[model samples]
Target: MIACNFSFHYTSFKCEKNFGVFLAVITIDLTSISVTSAVISMAGKVMKKESLSIEGKQGEQVSLLIQNQIKKLLSLFENEPIQIKAVGVSVPGICYSKTGLVWAPNIPGWDNYPLLQDISYLLRGKNIRIKIDNNRTCCILGEHWQGAAKETKNAVYLAVGSGIGAGILIDGKILHGFNDAVGAIGWFAVDRTYKDAYSEKGCLESLASGKGIITRVKESLNIIDDYSGYFKDIKIQNLVIGDVFDAYKQKDPIAQKIIRESVELWGITAANIISAFNPEILIFGGGVFGPGIFFIDEIKSEAKKWAQPLSIDKVKFSPSQLGNNAGLFGAGHLALGRF
Candidate 1:
């Protein structure tokens, strides 16, 4: 048997015989409802893997897609020597731990969705346990388990995709407050003056997330009289993040101003999280961070403007090494360890 050594949350799995119990872990990362199922060996190898995409679906249709995905994955691995044991899902919004309900704004018709109940019903009598968590928490767990935060007990994962959220790790434990809503930093009051719009996703996220970035560009295009350079050719409806960043490289004034403002907001938000959690490292991930990675240094520099002086210097800020896979790995670890 191959010797396997790794840490699962707080527990360490270290032994040669541990390989005999290789478990199939299904990670349902529902940013847009995608499924990734991997059979992980005790030796830390991903023995088998499969993925499915269910874009453009919503509500009960999405639920049915997930059930089919699980059934397909299980059937595919039916002949394998190891048995599937547990399933862990990373949801986009708040996942009520006790109620097993979900609320993701990005996925329509999911207000107070009974996700856990639906999944459980589909897998009835399978003898497999299921666990659920917010995607932010899963991102940090994945980083802690196999990515950037490997040796750190305290860490924060700031995910800026279509929206913003955070996953905090304090003393090696993921912080899940009442209702698992600890990391809903998108609603954080980052601005002094409040607009009715701020109430939707908070001041910081409205100005800094991918959706925010597009909104800013649209707002700029609408108000600016000088329709020259990159802004001259782009249509509001057809605009993408790549268009704005591409313009930023060529020194477009609109892109520069928007990016600069977003950098400061990211910095301020980073400071807020650091002051609140006092984490040793802040790992940046999510789709927005794919392009925003360029601003990490500037964000840290800006954080010094408002962050608690004592804690700011002690923290290190970096981009996530695991990229899109952070939540998947985290969900797998949650299945293997917590379930």
Candidate 2:
């Protein structure tokens, strides 16, 4: 019993005896927190959509959720007579299109999971085609298709959430490196002081990501014996990234210090990206950007300090207008390319 939240107009569409002639597509943005799916018309309109929370669920369990969403989306069109033509899935991590194997470290038991195979089996005997891609790739595609970066030839989407990653577009195409592992910018070295902690998550992400910020605050709290600030009343274990930003607004010294360092790291990361790609625009997105959007000016100023002089001036910085919908809309755009 899935609730169908539809915001589509199909009055112009005529339904005859052969209602199956009506064509539509499906798009899904599969992330660590939730799974969202939408029915997209050929004209790129989202007809109907549904989202399910899947936190703490494993890979196999998520597969079931995906199945449920698809079935529910398809059932909604029975009255409308629209036939589902294709499906495009935006995955959280590296998605190898050829093999349909997804390596999502965020999802337990998702490493090297046969996602395409699973979906194919689900849609067996149906003529519908499926395309799976990395979420970062879909982020830029979503932006290029309908969001901030429309018609832009070269652009980059810096997604700073619990972790950090990028989606690079060069000459109007998504850059997929060997093994399709491009845009893994979390491992970038933005900090000069190397630490044993930075080995797995990378220096930039360890310091700048939401998890990184929360962890840094907690670690600092543990070491500092006497510090009274916004976080003083809140237990250290209960601290989250949002608390840091809230405290920053209150002008808490500890929060200011932590966020200031993160700003520097984010700027360094942006500078490095601009210097390397020389994109037309660099869009910042992810969970952090919900409040993180406020720091765009600071990041740009920081980027100007280190980015190539020629490229820095050319690149315009923006917060993601589409937000989480970027991946969903981008997945729809990618499906449109399939034909």
Candidate 3:
């Protein structure tokens, strides 16, 4: 069911008769969804754009999908004058951009995987630069390059998705700490008392993320002796975050309690980001934000209770304008090697 989000994924790219020589670059957002596309930043045009399902594919299998996209991209311009200057990739978790090693926990068998090496083998004789970076880094890059954080020297892309992460920018440059493990804010301890649930993912992520919300909701569901609320029609096994948000909308008791906690935690996390970075703005995006978008104001209100007073007043929190394509666009920006 994964569909191409890029609009240019149709028909062969027509060669321009007199558009002048254009240096081309392509980028792929390779997670569960394979979003790959070629963008000509110079000409403000795109070519042979596409995306496909990379679901359940990990390690070498995932790299193969990327290789095939590169091959097809080359075939599109077969005998044409343009050459792919670079191919940028967006990967999950930690990625050593120089070493090409990735640690995508969501994708099975990809812990410390040599993704760049695998993709490089496929590029062979083609002289093209491949830039690979973490998804969090790419998210901030995309927002800074084209979204709400555009032109801001210091900003944070606080992504509240299935899991929580942040992409930090300081002085117009991404703050990739030593070993590139900088923005792993999931481990931030917001709770003083320890809970068994926080042992696995971390306090914030275990209690606030979409998966976290579902976990708490499910736990509550299991504890009730006999209850038939908004999720009465849904099987506990089939429950999802959307259902929880739906129940929240209906003011379901359990859903309200769970979401209220999540919102407060999100606000606390946002405050931490603002206090630490004192960024010009904080942009929020990711899967959970679909319904969570409506709670931005509420999150901000909660943030006021914990955030640095001066910093909170100076900072603005907004939803990501780039939406799902932030990583894709960020990868494209990476292809240009601007930073």
Top of the candidates by lDDT: 2
For model 1, the stretches where C-alpha displacement exceeds 4 angstroms are 1-21, 33-37, 42-44, 48-53
What is the Å distance of residue 2 in model 2 from its true position?
27
Q: Estimate the TM-score of every prediction.
A: 0.91, 0.91, 0.89
Determine which window of 10 residues in candidate 2 has minimal summed lDDT: 1-10
**Tens-digit lDDT string for candidate 3 (1-339):** 000111112222234332565567677886644545555443335565787877767678877777788788877776676766667788878886446678887777888888777767777677776678878888888888788888789989887777789999888878877677788888889999998877767899888887888888988988898877898789888787889999999999999999998899999999999999899999999888888999999999999999999999988888999898888778766766666
Error of 3 at 14 (Å): 23
Error of 1 at 118 (Å): 1.3
Error of 2 at 280 (Å): 0.6
Q: Write the per-residue lDDT of candidate 1 for residues 78-153, one digit (tens) a residue.
A: 8766666767778888888667788888887898899888888877888776777888988998898889998999
lDDT of 2 by residue, 35-72 (tens): 99999876667888888899889979998889888878
TM-score of the candidate numbered 2? 0.91
Of candidate 3, the 10-residue stretch with the lowest lDDT total is 1-10
